[model samples]
Target: MSAEKKPAPKVEPLRKTRPCPECGKPSQREHYPFCSNRCRELDLSRWLSGSYAIPVAGDEAMADGEDEN
Candidate 1:
C-alpha cells in the first residue's frame, strides 16, 4: 500500500503597516509605534475627552440627587 504525504503547514506573510489609525496617513519612520505624532496625540485626546466613556452605577450622592428630582 502507498502512503499519502501530508501537505506542509501554511505560513502567514509578513505585512508592513501603512496607515495611521487616527488620520489615515502613510506611516513614517519617526513614528515607529504609530504612523505619526498626530495619531498618538489624537489617541490621547480621545482618552482625555471622554471618547471612551463607561457606564457605572450611581453613588449615594447621585442617587439622592435623582430621588430629589
Candidate 2:
C-alpha cells in the first residue's frame, strides 16, 4: 500500500502590535490601543470625566461675553 501525505496548511502571521496608550504595554487585538479591559475602561473613564479636552480658537472678545462692532 502507498501512503499519501497531505499538503501543509498555510499559517497566518500575527498583526503588528503597538504600545498601549494607558499602561505602555503591548496592545492586544481585542483591546486595540489598550492592553486589557481595565486599561480600556480607564481611558474611557477619563474621557467621560472630562479629563481630556480639545482646544478651540476664536475671538477673545466673543469668548469673554462681549459685543463686536
Candidate 3:
C-alpha cells in the first residue's frame, strides 16, 4: 500500500501591520504597534511620568464640591 501526504492548512494573522506610534516604523509581531522594545518602554515611561493627561472642562459646581439635587 502507498502512503499519501496531506498539505498543511493556511493560517491568518489576528492583527495587521501598521506604522509604530513612537518611531513611525513598521511594527513587529512580537512588539506589536511598536517597532522595538525601546520604543514601547519610552511610551510607558511617558504615561507613568504624567507626561500625558486627559483634558477636562472647568466646571465650577464640581470644583466647589456642590452636588446638584
Candidate 2 clashing pairs, residues 3+ apart or interchain: none
lDDT per residue as tens, model 1, 1-69: 999999989875545867777777777666744687878888889999999788777687776665555
lDDT of 3 by residue, 35-69 (tens): 99999999999999999998778887897999988
> On lDDT, who's better, 1 or 3?
3
* Preferred candidate (TM-score higher): 2 or 3: 3
What TM-score against the true fold does each predicted structure earn? 0.42, 0.64, 0.68
For model 1, state the Cα shift of residue 49 in Å: 1.9
Q: What TM-score does candidate 1 get on C-alpha atoms?
A: 0.42
Model 1 misplaced stretches (Cα beyond 4 Å): 1-15, 54-69
Q: Please give the range of 10 consecutive residues that has the lowest summed lDDT in model 2.
A: 7-16
Return the top candidate by lDDT: 3
- Candidate 1 lDDT score at position 53: 86
> What are the root-mean-square deviations of the candidates from the true structure over C-alphas?
7.8, 7.6, 5.3
Model 2 misses residue 14 by how many Å? 5.7
